[model samples]
Target: MPTTAAESQFDELGSLYEDVVDWPFRRDIELPAVLHSLGDLTRSDVLDFGCGAGLYTRLLAGQGARRVVGYDESEGMLREARHREAKEQRGIEYVSQLTPALAHRFDVVLSVYVLPYVASRDGLRQMCASMARMLRPGGRLLALPLHPDYDPHSDYYTAYGFRLVSESPHVEGSPVRLELRVRGVEADVTAYYWSRGALEEALHGAGFGPVFWAAPWPPGLARIEDAPTVQRAYLRRPHAAMLDCRLARAAE
Candidate 1:
């Protein structure tokens, strides 16, 4: 399968990368929004594509997905994910290679923050195609790509507990540096953004139907005590957005 140019960035990151998931924006907002968007998973089979550290993979199992597979190209991430799986004893599968049996084997494919790593427009479409091939005819894909309208200024998002720094000429595929800021967490990851049209075009070319974009929401369900002031600012300028779409059914 074709891989992203930045795939190796997480290879040696291992356990340290897990801390990024605890960033407040993800804990209170992104996590709930994604799970709510997935709806019921009572008996569904899920594929957590680019499942670094198995954060959501573990949660999917807790949410009652019958079979959860955490697939990643990074051994560093997988090591941490597998360790957690062993320690927690969730029947989740971790794999770096896609076998023939996995094709069209999932009811849902969920990706978080994976899209930004694709190095090119064609690479993005290829990534989508790979995801499509793993789904059933009418399966759903919920991905959290960099919001096409994300603030380019570094400090615009610091109040949300992270920083985004990108150079001028914010065109398609412009590389952005994401810095995670928590008391003990340290992360600086590179990401590339695509325009709305580019995202739609790629998904459609890969056999997905119309895309639905969701803005970041405050944690109304969990209400995790995040200040109203910060919530309002981040809601209005979330650096990431929910992208919900589905693969075309066979009859189409």
Candidate 2:
């Protein structure tokens, strides 16, 4: 993977990266949505793209995945992941990039909060193609990227410890920079934007079928009338969007 400004930013984050994504919104809402989309993992071969700190990779291993390999471009992030793997002995494999030998080897390829780091449409297309190649026939790709409808200016929920310093017009392929504060440390992060149409086209071009958008709130949310006010508010304006896709059965 080519080095980008975002990759360098993540490298600097390193071990501190875990704290940035440890908010309740991720644990209570985003993770559940991802797991729901994943359905079952028993004996499945899984690939975690951009698997920072091996958080989800370890989780998938715990869920009975037969084989789990995590790939990330940032060495600093991988260092943290390696540290945890050595300590926990979860049998997870971490690599910097996918090699050609591993093509079509995974039953499921999951990426979370990674697509926005792609700085160009061509980069996103290549990413989709690589993800497609990673999956076997009928394999699924579950991705969670920043929502196209996200309003950097909104104050609906501000407890996540980040603020938008500046934003470009919400046009396709624009850039958005954010100022993040975690554990009394501050940093600037940059991410690119993709309209729904742009993302759909990239997926389809890479041999993925129609993309399905999953709701932020799970089905069981309807039964919980006593849900916390913050939870309900977060659901109303989710910062992230779930994209569920699958490799075509006839894909080469």
**Candidate 1 lDDT by residue in tens digits, 11-70:** 877676677577777777778888888878987999999999899998899999989999
- Supply candidate 1's per-residue lDDT for 116: 87
For each candidate in the order shown, give its overall lDDT on alpha carbons. 0.84, 0.80
For model 2, residues 24-117, the per-residue Cα lDDT tens digits are 7777777766777677799699999989888889889888899999999988899999998999899999999789877999999999878888
**How high is each candidate's TM-score?**
0.92, 0.92
What lDDT is reached at residue 184 by model 1? 61
Which candidate leads the pack in lDDT? 1
> Lowest-scoring 10 consecutive residues by lDDT in candidate 1?
218-227
User: In model 1, where do residues sit more than 4 Å from their true spots?
Assistant: 219-227, 249-252
